[model samples]
Target: MLTYFRQRYPTRIEIDEDGNTVEVPLSDPMLEAKLHIALSTDGRHWFPLNANEPVWDQWMRDPYVRRGPDGVWRILTTGTTDGYNRDASGPGCFFASSKDLIHWNDERTLPLMEEVRDASGNFLANNIWAPEWFYDEENEEYILIWSSSFKDAGWKESRLWYSKTKDWKNFTPAKVFFEPPYSVIDGTLLKHENAYYLFHKEEEFGAKTGERRAIRLATSKKLEGPYQIVDGDLNDGQIVPVITEGPTIIEDPENSGWLLYYDYCMTNRYGASFSKDFLNWEILDDVHFPADARHGCVSKISSEEARTLINEYNISSSTDK
Candidate 1:
């Protein structure tokens, strides 16, 4: 079974001055964009796991779910608290673990940015975004990678940073993971045949820069890298649309190649591309996803586990395909 964990934006209906009913977005959409679940037998059709309600309702975004070697599922999300520094910047990302995917526990902040500092020994990051976990088989540890923007640059130049941990409780000091010439964020890794591919969003725009806000690729031999960008048609080697972000890739369930999916933010929909070599890609036009799903990762789950979640959440077959 295929499982998708994502952020959902809900709305409320209200009457206007003309007595017309209008769908109004939540008062604080970002805070309300909580974690939701969807399940699929095939990659093409999806069913909401909890009647379209958020499975983990909290102020979080960009939920990445991965099951560890210990048989526990863990989630790292873009979250924050009011107790940290009393500013707009998030002290760190949010974390939670579960033996089963339905009920989560041990929810807390990782405080990752606290360990990141400048030459003056002061914390430099103003925000932490899109934390993802990659397990290194050779090193026998998990590497947590995320994007951060420095205070010195007024949070303009976002780059990827990472830390290593065997247990989630303690992490190695945060350090620069990837610092390209241009601003980048939403970094996700794919390991194939002893090579590591990095898919990230180039967060630059405008006529002067001649850059686009789209997904780009970089590759390295080691998990942590001196990565070289793959040259392509778009500026800085982009592979997708001009207004896309939040890229996530999965092995095709019914095919040999891989499916790379991303959020078309400007159009409020999802798009996909397919690749077998990871060097050449074909944008797919007929793919489908659950309505309004945003910025999530896909993982395979056991059929028994999927059934349990479906029963617990009362997911109906009538949901959108």
Candidate 2:
């Protein structure tokens, strides 16, 4: 689909009702999701991941884009980008699927019948942060990882929850995968060899003069885990805090080295990193960065899916004026 933009002005017209002139201020949908100001019909292709046209009428944020086995690239993100106030307890993770990376269809009505909640019996709830999902080939299971809050808890106390299913139409109840006074937000998972590795960013307490957050890792012997922290570096390995977040790791099909992608908040640019081992990482500048005026952030890079879209499909490029 093509997009169009216009500079709109709210024209004031007085309407006489009974004996009074009533006026209304035309409403403008919030342009930015909590973090992402733009979106894409394709997997964040073109620039300004958001459309040139205003498609997101609700408050959508923390998008996790992935491709399912059926050749459908599914984007699961938080917020309605239109209707919900965030605390209203609506469908937090908005799911959208696309085939050519240009035209997208919201999958919210896909009959997702799975129900997973927090340990407190408070049902799957708020914040609706970065959401990542994968197809487990071995178990034929689909696992979704996202940052969510318990209905009764504080914001920084958000926990990472995982739901498993064999089909996208059905989901299992959310169970806490990670939690904290450490304030862990977005948890990204990858299946490599004999174990499952998870990378997450957490807000650290008071530190030196200019410290912000830390990116850490945890490993599990099984998908369902008693996970153990492997290593954590809040310093961005010297990249700085504002430049670090939305970490996603995937195996490079060209070699054994893994690639990591994330949005650099400080410079408002997205980049890639490489690691022979999941712990030691080095950022690379070869991958193209989306060029949105609002930081032009990329929510994630799913190598398995993005590769197919970029290489095989007839993807279209978009730019919003």
Candidate 3:
């Protein structure tokens, strides 16, 4: 029992007419849905760059964001603001920028550039999930790594694809990064020590994919490479998660360790853990605290610091409790 230690912040907040903090509600029906977004931080509390706006586009799940060279934050996600209509089977990838993590502007239709149409010239009408944008400083371009099932591609046969973009306005043709011989999804790539490594969920058998998914690692010496798994492997590492999807690694700001965030299951819930290195993960069991909202990605904030923020942000919470 001691292996699991969860602290659920079963409380709610009330904002005033001016959109400022006002009172605390004992219960928040909006909790789960409100916690809906794949919340991120500018190094603090988890939040949406622009939550609930027309520009948002799609279901907006599995977020991959990074700060660009100019200290400007750029976000690329699976879906757009309006999300995917039935006509469009895939939630298209998009670009949004924010100086801070709270406010964001869509680079899709307005301000930034036009939408990325497909080869048919009708725009891609299929599934493209977990998009990772990689910046090549030397090439002065951005490359996209995404899980796509476009044009007759089957879910069980999912593959990773790549494309190039220079000004965020134009995108070149996309081709299969590696799409064969295995059921691989959620291709998250990382550049480490001058090598580029891509991680994906490898299925042993059957179409059932989930939190129990195995994370397979592949590497290429150059950006453009014949990417190969470490030892022709299919996620045979002892530390890397199996049945775990969406592997995101953040280097611990305080030390050399890396904190990894990934999906524990469906339903708005997930888990947090830290790794001494990228290979293994130690789950922060029952370590829940007052997150900015329910189901939001728990930020780097510790339980103690979260308590402080809750006390500070929603003072009336205790009264309602």
Candidate 4:
């Protein structure tokens, strides 16, 4: 914890609102501990919602945002106390809930990997990464999912696991959610029409030649899925040569289409593509993201909510703050 005060981590605001993906560069972590808020009516250009105000103080990875049934805005992210990425030896997942994204107070932690064990009493996974949850409207529960690797298996064997929760206080024991033939991480889900679309980063060697870390798609009819990967070109002919990870899916509120946001980590760039139907994609250009932004989720809020957030967090009206 002392390291936090001594060293500031690189953080960025990466969000997908409506159809456009916007990434904002935060000046410093200590100043924006709660996290700076920004809003985009057009989605392409973003305006700051708060001026150097902290939205959240805790460290998070692959942070996901969603509104809960109780009308609280909840963020479920991979929680870590030490080390970079998801290698820390603390809570497997961290959760925080807020009526406004600015004043988050409700908090909870789950030692999922430590608690859930195999028949041999060995922990199934230790390095938990990218935890996310969405409301299962039909079932009336929130289905939480994340990626983790088993102790017996190596990190390359990382796969997704899920649990159910209602009040965000207690959760059902973790269970395997999706297991592709190869190692995978950074799993995200978006429901369209009646089917659920899952986007994940898979580790595999390209069929013809070299090592490949690519974004792949899978689909299922039910929320608790036996998701099948959509077979085709992994990058859809875009982002060739450079690999990508951390795929986020969101509905295009403006066009009714969908947007896929991913990370080009090697280049430290955020990428996006649009699709009316999930099958076809047109890689989008002109999308700008903060250099430090890595894996984070986006969500849409009402205009009133946005204004309230700005006022509440004291985001300066003038851009130059």
Candidate 5:
């Protein structure tokens, strides 16, 4: 199942002072900033459920869905109370659980950043976004990672923060998970063999420094760690191009390699890269996604599960052949 957020922009046409009509984009209070689920036989083409309406009607974005060890599906999203008033600062993200993909419950804010503090007991996080779940089979615990900016840094720089939790109800104090010299966000983890590969976005766009807004990689021997940046001939350490974010990696269904999908925000299109090893990647062509699909994660679903969601949402005709 492919889970994403559908962004809606309502516009109104008005006569300007120069007597010419112009279409002005208006803000949506809801922002249509809710979770939408879709089904795809192949990862390229997607058919939206609920007639392209949001499956979960909540003001959240960047939905990451994963089934826990208990066989229950859980989703974590960037949470905000008022969609219009949202900024680069927030208290925490939101969480929801589901037995089946059709019905979700236990929706509430995680309040993760409330526990993040500096040595002087000062809470420095101004914004929290893109919380991802990684189950550490070695440690038998779950790690929740997200990005945050600091009050001390004037919220200009961001880094990945993480916490350990055995149960979803309780979490250890948040600590810096990965902090490079530059700002980073939207981290997704892939564990291969004994190493963990973190694919994330470098948020810097300094023209003089030639820093492009693109996705880069870092790997570590441990889950929470001193991750070293993988820099070499792999596009000079950047796998994807500029203006790409919200990366979700999944294994190729054909068992040939791995597929990494990211949101090309500037072009409103989804881009993909193919990789066998974590170090090298090839940008793929001929990938297609649902119109207006924004930042979200992709998970493989069984044939029965796909049929269940399609029947429940009554979107049989929407599926692409």
Candidate 6:
């Protein structure tokens, strides 16, 4: 039997030495029904961890996974009926928890905007995309940030909005987190050596450059403060002025360098870059990642936690039949 291979992007370019181009064949369409957890041990080399049940049947995009104080893995993802980012509703972000990432609990939509209002004094948001939380140990507060469009912006511009909470039940008034001259989305923050680094995608386009959705960096002395666009070289000489989003930065546990990963949505794959001083980057090619993995945050977990999840879930690198 001859197997028919389908390309995710029909117009994807592939150049040869002589300047000849070819259409690249990407993923197999046979794997679409298997929605599994994308797990990686080395920030690269990702594999699909099959779930015993079809837990998420709908739109579960931009998943942010982190370990809570109660020693449980919690996930807050953008929830919608059609699995499209533009179709996100006002019920806020979706929430779920698990002890071993095998058996999930408390799966429901969290009303993050119910008690909070926008600049127009309205508590409604047209879209809620990629809700992520950062725990400040010193202040004992959870800083929640997500991309949303407002009535004043005519739902045309997406910006990063934030709220703080000690307990998830009660939240501080939502406010603008980062708004540049243009629009931005998929904001992720990292604190290193008393400085806060914010990574976000700026939505801009020009005649020369089409769909200028590039991941950029900003720095601030405080968590909520006047962050400025990072001066000097950012991508370590990498030409990344377009077609990137969902930048997730984490310190290399094995080394002193930092691993920065972004969704190369143009090619439908994740692209990674490594930096030591946060100014220069070495683009890592051929890093393994899940094909179906979308915008998601990564966290370091204990070895026991990974072992428990693998054992309980019967998770293998390959999809189960």
Local accuracy of candidate 1 as per-residue lDDT tens digits, 43-129? 666677676667766767778888888899988887753212314333688889999887889998887878666687666777778
Q: Pick out the ten consecutive residues of candidate 2 with the lowest summed lDDT.
A: 1-10
Clashing pairs in 4: 33-56, 34-54, 34-55, 34-56, 35-55, 50-315, 51-315
lDDT string, candidate 4, 142-203, tens digits = 88888887533223578888888876767788888999877778788888789998888876
What's each prediction's TM-score?
0.85, 0.64, 0.62, 0.78, 0.85, 0.78
In order, what lDDT does every prediction score?
0.76, 0.53, 0.49, 0.63, 0.76, 0.64
lDDT of 6 by residue, 1-321 (tens): 000011134344444555344566555422232224555667766655444233345346666777777677777776663322332324477777778765778887766666455577655666677788888877988899987766433224777889898877678877888887667788888989899888888765444334556777888999986788764353332224467777788887556899887777556666678888887777788677655344546677667866665565555454232
Off by over 4 Å in 2: 1-59, 82-91, 109-124, 151-155, 207-212, 233-243, 253-256, 285-288, 292-321
lDDT by residue (36-85, candidate 2, tens digit) is: 22333333233433433334443345555556778776666654543222
Q: What is the C-alpha RMSD of each candidate to the true structure, in Å?
A: 6.8, 10.6, 11.7, 8.4, 6.2, 7.4
The deviation in Å at residue 94 for candidate 1 is: 0.2
Least accurate 10 contiguous residues by lDDT in model 1: 81-90
Cα error of candidate 3 at position 34, Å? 7.8
Question: What's model 4's lDDT at 41?
Answer: 60
lDDT of 3 at 152: 43
TM-score of 6: 0.78
How far residue 52's Cα lies from its native spot in candidate 3, in Å, is 14
Q: Which candidate ranks first by lDDT, i.e. highest?
A: 5
Could you tally the backbone clashes for each prediction? 0, 19, 20, 7, 1, 2
Clashing pairs in 5: 89-126
In model 4, what is the error at residue 56, expressed in angstroms?
2.3
